[model samples]
Target: MTEPRFHGPDFAALEASDPEIAGIVLDELDRQRGGLQLIASENLTSPAGLAAQGSVLTNKYAEGYPGARYYGGCEVVDRAETIAIERAKALFGADHVNVQPHSGASANLAVYAAFAQPGDSVLAMSLPHGGHLTHGATVNFSGRWFTAVPYHVRKDTELIDYDEVRELALVHRPRIIVAGATAYSRELDFAAFRAIADEVGAILWVDAAHFIGLVAGKAIPSPVPYADVVSATTHKVLRGPRGGMLMCRAEHARAVDKAVFPFGQGGPMMHTIAAKAVAFGEAQTESYARYAAQVVANARTLSTSLVDAGMRAVSGGTDTHLILFDLQHLRIDGRTAEARCAAAGITLNKNAIPFDPAPPAVASGIRVGSAAVTTQGFDAEDMNAVGSLVARAVRAEAGTADGDRELAAVKDEVTTLVARKPAYPVI
Candidate 1:
């Protein structure tokens, strides 16, 4: 009989030590390989990046910035952090970069720590109008601590109203004017935002968590030049680890660094920092630029295809990787649509459309994204087919035999499609 292999750095060893957890890991791999991932804020990180995240650096606890550590034995981790900061600075064209924040929300918290007091006013897009919760939802710390001033998209246009934003800024004179969104599908006018912020003497902080990856790839206009500070995620379109990063102008460098280190968080996650460095290096490649361009193209194609399949594309269509679909025409709620898509081997999420009639729990919109599929080597034509499949899935009436047949058919077709270009193609 073969001896139990309880050793390091191998799946066999993990299986021998803990079969239950190992089986779960393998099952998740199988699920990812077998299905379509269309979550707007999600992406498939490279194996190299994953290796860095799973590296021995995880054992080290680097508590401060490079070269200035609270922990004694952080010399090696410091080097990894310095590399990450330099690469992020180069990628985003910012004078300062902090790769310490654990998530985009953490990065935003650091920004608030750096720039404003608890009672200061914060002007950001309203959550129901395509903004992130960190922007100032009532339940979030941002809204609870600060005087939250919300803005909205135009009723007819279904797009951000610059005039309204300017008006709000002028009236509120918020300490920080946030310019970014979580679900909005249009490119932001960072220059316009800068002008507004300057007019009101408010700090222009862009929450680029959803679209920073495209900026890194040079596929979209960067807010780095216009905003006073930009907080972003290393994942999503950026295709790094599940981490947060902040970039800012030179004037705020010290404040930003202090905010990330001693204020917002305690110790730096050195392994994730190293993984972010790997991702930033990869983003500098020409292939990444091409991938970014394809992402937008696929999104536009997918939105158009969904429109053809009787869904109303919010804002007439998308100019970015995300597409928000209003499902009022079909009379199906976003929750139901999300479940239907999942049953058909496609994954997406329920979202609220601008001025949605239904509550958030049963929102009126479904959000789709192209970044993951594009990373999986899917193209415009593939997105078109995906749109058709999504439409069929959403229209199927669950709990009925006809709906079951339709779901089975869609699942079979999805299985065939994903097989052609499986995620993590090697294994």
Candidate 2:
């Protein structure tokens, strides 16, 4: 458990003996092991997943699906990918599974390629209204290829308005209807979205990248049954390798496979896929279901605690694993809050709230999430304490003279909180 600069060999020795890459890698590993990662899209993979990811399987190049690969030495990689695909299908209850895309955005792009051509219409959540870049942000490749028609939440409610979505569907009649979000709080109404898609002759594609682990735990409804295809990242709540997968009906299996293989990428990352299989297998257990439920409960507790601390949370609270706190309500800047929080040993991201008054980089809100802390074994009560410390820090910065002193106290509180919760247990 000794740090690199301590017990580990010198950088020059590693660079010469292994590769210059070894030095870069070990440095990153040191940073990750020491820092607090609160980003909602990130997680600590299990030991089994990590071991697979760091295995010699990475040396293999598996060009196709199991048993039908173009490569000569793909026998073991075939098993790894086949296991990953099967576990994904079983966990989500889908007829087909393709565990090849390198990232969530890639998975989404494959979905678009399978269903729509360039300039075809797509109904997706608005970016400012809790949408992802791939969902149709003008700067993204998805928007570059397709004309994106977006739906937003009610201005007053700060949550998705199904009535508005239905109206948009009626007017646009898009080729695909996407249901999922990056920042929105309340649970999505997948059934309502399915109905809208049916009326408009559109295919329902659910991107449950953020909440797949929750669905496995039964904390939320799974979209596999309601959608034509589902795309997700295995790393988030699923706690796997940094990769993506596609699940869909049997009819689209061939198209999905082609889209992910020859269409989206070349030889798959067999090592990561091997790691994903381990992660998916872990998700199939009773313990992982309990872990998934703990993620949501911790999120709610964090959201409620922030509200009590006088910060305005989007949709008033959270039903999933993330919460957006409006820092402007406390007369603070999201950028400043982010920097101060990190200095205080608390970690999270600065995110744009629905209809945020500020720009993207310097948003009006900070998003705090529970997935990482929950993985570290912090539960609801721990989140309550964490939330109060955040409120105190924000309020302190808003004041004069004594503010910096109070920030010190907040830092100590965070140190104590982590001491009680601790980081991930060593393998």
Candidate 3:
């Protein structure tokens, strides 16, 4: 008989080699199992995605695109990437797709490089007002290398004022206009953005990182029809491995692909691309549409419950899977609320509300998401209970004796509720 073939490094072997890391991984798994994950940008990947991400493809180094790699042994990875590119094109109805970006930020940077020269003016949403860091934050490359002009939501209505967007574009005359948000709960007006960009002769770029999955499932309108280029992360509501993708008109395909390869990053991560293929295929199924619809419904239910518990939800309610609440009325800050909720086995992030008075570290808002919990099978009734728990925890004092008791009590309830549902039942 032939000698037994060596497959790959198994977790069992890893435990023997490095027990410390193995133990930490197990601890993290347990923590995820026992707590409520409400982070708006997080979701559990499917088993197929996980397996693909950890496959033998990780050992390969394909330095270039599928057919024109700088290294050898790329034939198999080339096929995997071709599948990913084709599926992304079908899913988004785009003329071209680039699957080499490492993250959403990288994708945005590539788009900027493709369309605008260094120091050219670019307009995007304000970071404190729901925009992402890559969208012209002062410390980011997009801000440093370009003339970054930011717009904000109206303080009175807590919504994007399209008229103001047009005015800003007319005044600034930016080379590119970016329309997307990280914390805003309303649906974006992509057509309006396109019109404004046209008035200014600017390229409209939509970073739909948070809602690509919803668009794929037809739960929300797509930006592909209006945007000149669109960038998105695969890991959020898309529920894929951690990676990024770019879709654009066929005319700009060469520039975008070149920017991602030689300009923004080195070799593409083939393993992640394979995982993305798995996710894109999964998104084409009927069940994903149901999941997407349920995510939106869960968000609305959670926002309503929070309002019922006397907390003020930003924009009154959500039209997406995210809910941003102003913590000012609760007599607490975002940092305190985040800590208290975490103490009670709930995980979320502090955010800045429109016209927030406090600093970023101690902002006057808390943002919660329903995607992860919905993935774990949470529905409207469960969201009501979660909202109650959040309210109670935020209302509790951090350093007081009674506060400790209230937090402990809420933690017990959260543990009991979450224990009933597993995020990955088959795992």
Candidate 4:
């Protein structure tokens, strides 16, 4: 007699059991399929990643590291996590890897916890000038616990001023200097940052959450060799599940692991770890390298097109997967542009530009990325058309009949284009 095969939960059964949630899920699926997703931080996960995230491993409670789990029945989860660790190490060429942080913020926090005590000084990029909230934003834990000295981009060039960074680091003498950004479009000078850290006797922590995939594919430079610790989210350009990872030099491995486990979070999400393993494996492929290259090319194309259509790409143009453009030239606020573009079926986030006069709520700029669209099979040509649609939508007057007509026309075109390129054809 053969052993019985196990099957997963049926969505039809779920629909019958919880129709409201099921309907909402279906609606969201429809929404994703219908519109463009230009959010710089968002990406569509692979079908294999989706399956791993929804796997039975979610039921497991592996409280400790793989080999020394506090709970029972973790033999398989141990293997999954170990695979994730090894794959990440191979991909990034790190001395050690931690695949358990729940989000990128958590990863950064753990790094901070490992390196600095309360009241220690941290030098990082300012939030309004393209840095992430975890990187010493005033309201965040890093700022609340540690003394945060933020660096800024130059007003004239709208780019990070390494001279100023060195000046600040010398004055503050911070314990850690975080080098990375959330909305910055230019390639960071990681080697310069490392030198500053060395000069200041500070730990160089790089938050590569936005560009890890590019680094992995060699489309951009890696921070692993230059930084003491590097943190990243698996979701962004990595195109994995919504989780975080930390890679570090061998000396910090034990401290980093302790911080992530008993200090930062409880039991690890084994399901997400499984998903991360799948994504890391996928990133190792030749196709992913091509995809990463295309993501940058598409961003450059979109930036040029936006400039041609009357917007200014921040720092002139992009060197990675994102573009930050100011809307002040068009006499438009980021809020109004975001709303109008949403109406026209183009999705993106309002962002604060360098030296932005406008407040964060109604920022002076919009941030666009090529990761999601590239995942959906968009090329440079498609990006040009996307830039045109974005320009037309944002240029429309709000709450007017003419504006409504223009938005409708753009929405129809977006719908037709998006229909031709579905986000998840395997699904």
Top-TM-score candidate index:
4
**Candidate 4 C-alpha error for residue 265, in Å:** 0.7
TM-score for every candidate vs. truth?
Answer: 0.98, 0.92, 0.97, 0.98
Q: How much is 240 displaced in model 3, in angstroms? A: 0.3
Q: Candidate 2: list runs displaced more than 4 Å.
A: 1-36, 398-401
lDDT of each residue in 218-295, candidate 4, tens digit only: 899899999999999999999999999999999999999999999999999999999999999999999999999999
> Which is superior by lDDT, 2 or 4?
4
**Candidate 3 Cα misplacement greater than 4 A, ranges:** 1-9
lDDT of each: 0.93, 0.85, 0.92, 0.93
Candidate 3 all-Cα RMSD:
1.8
- lDDT of model 2, residue 79: 84
lDDT of 3 by residue, 1-427 (tens): 9976866557898799999999998888888888899999999999899989998899899998988999998999999999999999999899999998999888998998899998999999999999998888888888888898889898888899888889989999999999999999999999999999999999999999999989998989999999999999999999999999999999999999999989989999999999999999999999999999999999999999989999999988998999999989767999999999999998999999988999999999999999899889998889999989988998988789999999999999999989888677665
* Residue-wise C-alpha lDDT for candidate 1, range 161-240, written one tens digit per residue: 99999999999899999999999999999999999999999999999999998898888899999999999998999899
Model 3 whole-model lDDT (C-alpha atoms): 0.92
Supply candidate 4's per-residue lDDT for 156. Answer: 85
Residue 390 error for model 2, in Å?
1.6
Which sequence of candidate numbers ranks them by lDDT, best first? 4, 1, 3, 2
Each prediction's number of clashing residue pairs: 1, 0, 0, 0
